[model samples]
Target: MDAPAERLQAADAELQEIDERIAEIGRQNLDAVADAYKEFSAVLDRYEDRATDRDDFQGYIEFREQMAEVLGSIPDDLPHRDAFTEADDELTTGVTSVLKHANFDRARSQLEPAREYAELRSREQDVQGTYRDARSALQKEQSTLETERNELERLKRLGEADLDAPVSLLREPIEAYNDAVAEAFDSFTHAASARAVLDLVAETTAYPLVEYRPPPENLHEYVHESAVGEESLSRLLDLAGYSSSKLDHYVENPQAFRSNVATNQSYLSGLSATPLQVSWPPVASDALGWHMRERIAVVGRFATDEVVALARAVRDLGLRDDYERLRTSATARESLSETDRTRLRAGEIERDLTTHRASLDSVREILATYPPLGRR
Candidate 1:
């Protein structure tokens, strides 16, 4: 068993032992002991200050009466009957005017049996608390084990890859196509109107992986409605930097351009074709095929025909039978580090995975075996 499971087991055993001891003493008998002692202790506490050393004569009288009543209330058949009698005898000093701390101390010692039974319940409660803490710790460890398993499984999958595969067969074509399209999109953004380029980006919202932040609402509206929409983005950004007097010569409303276009200078400058390009490791063939088909249409709308042809070439590559193997190898090469490769070759990862699974199972078993100690 794991450390958590072992701790749970120890706590469970201690709790069970406490329960058994409580059972042996008989719960009813122990309860009667606790009640009598509660009343017994109460009388001592109340009169300890006032009745001792003749501090108050009436308080001494009241203290003795209450002690006698407490002893009288105990059932004749109650276990350890002598302890109560002894405790009462210790308090009875014939014609004594005042009781002292020594008298109370002697009485308390005689009542040790009652205290023992009363404290048994407290001991049981303490053990139950420990069991509860152990259970919570085991549960947290189980959750951590699940996360570890997932991460290790990913590493194992990478380790199984055929590293000798000519991944460049796939990477070369995809990289070439990616470079061609990136350059083409840059040229498209420089030549096309801002409205045209942004509109094309907006259309890509239907494809999840082709991520582009949707154009700002006010900016989108400005590009679509304003006459300045016809100007290329590169030209507009250069025009936005001009002085208000110079900008007025270029556009009808200089203030309008400042609010709608110049205010969004950061957003406009950040737009790029990076999201349009495929990842180096590439997705599964079917997903890549689907993604490329959608991208082909989107890129074709604004990019050069040569760029469009390169996108088509990437889509064709995804259809090849060797693509999955090469993609897996590429993913392994890109993701795995020297330490990870060493562990994988040494079979240490597999051993670690097995150990985690066993620990998780042990904790689960301990939890199933011993539920919480509820009201008893």
Candidate 2:
């Protein structure tokens, strides 16, 4: 069990002890005796000041009558009957006797059993409240443990992949294709028109795995509509930095270039073939095949025959029988940390999973018993 479950068990034990003591007191009929003592004490408060030394002679008669009635009210089978009878006898020793506070103190001491019964019931209530608070604390801990258990299960699934399988078969072709395409696209972007590059990027919006940010609306319109669109992206950026009068000699409208091209220098300069490259730990065979098909179509428009041939090789990797096996192995090798591998080897993950499942079972069992009725 966890810390919260342990604390709840302790509180439940204490509450049971208090309940047993209270039940024992009830069986002795001391609760009835306590009611009698309350009545006897109230009578003393009303008549003691007036009756003492016969200060009010009529008050003395009334005091004796009330005390007699209180004593008569007690059942014969009640526990501590002698104590009440003796306390009453001391209060009525003489009609005109000097009644001191010492007599009252002695009478209360004689009725100790009745007082004890009242105190035990009060203690029972306090312990019951503590039991409820402990139950709520256990419930909160159970929720947090469930989330951690789910993450551990995911790690266990990932650890099952074959670590020694030849992932390099898939990695070699992807790396070669990624490098060839990047160098080829860089040459195309430097020498080609800004319009041609934007058109190529726009064709890839249909392919989800190709994560290219679409060109800004105003910038796309400026590149396709303005004569400045004919210049390479590198030359357009260079013209944007010149003074307005000097910029006029380079482009048809200098102010239009500032609003359209200069204002969007970051977007145009950051565009590249990086998005077309496949990732190191490749995706599933089916997904990579679809992504490669779209890449071949877009890169084929301007890239050399050699780069297009490399891309075709990557696309064909999905047709191999061992593709899925190699992909899963590659993912595990790249994703798992050194600590994760150590724990899996030592069987720590399975042990931890079992522990959390047992803790949840224990927490739920206790909650069902207590019901958390009076939660603190």
* Per-prediction TM-score: 0.67, 0.57
Off by over 4 Å in 1: 1-3, 10-133, 243-245, 370-376
lDDT values for all models: 0.85, 0.80
For 1-376, candidate 2 gives per-residue lDDT tens digits of 6666666677778777866775776644645765676777788777767657456777777878888888888887777788888888787676457676677777778777766765565565676666666776877877877887887786787789888999889999989998998899888888999888887777778776777888887888889999889888788889878889899898888888899889988888888888889887887778878989888888888899999999989988988999988888888898889998899889998899898888778777878876664552
- How do the residues 53-111 of candidate 1 rate in per-residue lDDT, one tens digit apiece? 57588888888788878888999899888888988887787546567888889988998
The lowest-lDDT stretch of 10 consecutive residues in candidate 1 is 367-376
Clashing residue pairs found in predicted model 2 = none
What is residue 22's positional error in candidate 1, in angstroms?
A: 11
For this target, which candidate reaches the highest lDDT against the unseen true structure? Answer: 1
Supply the global lDDT for candidate 2: 0.80
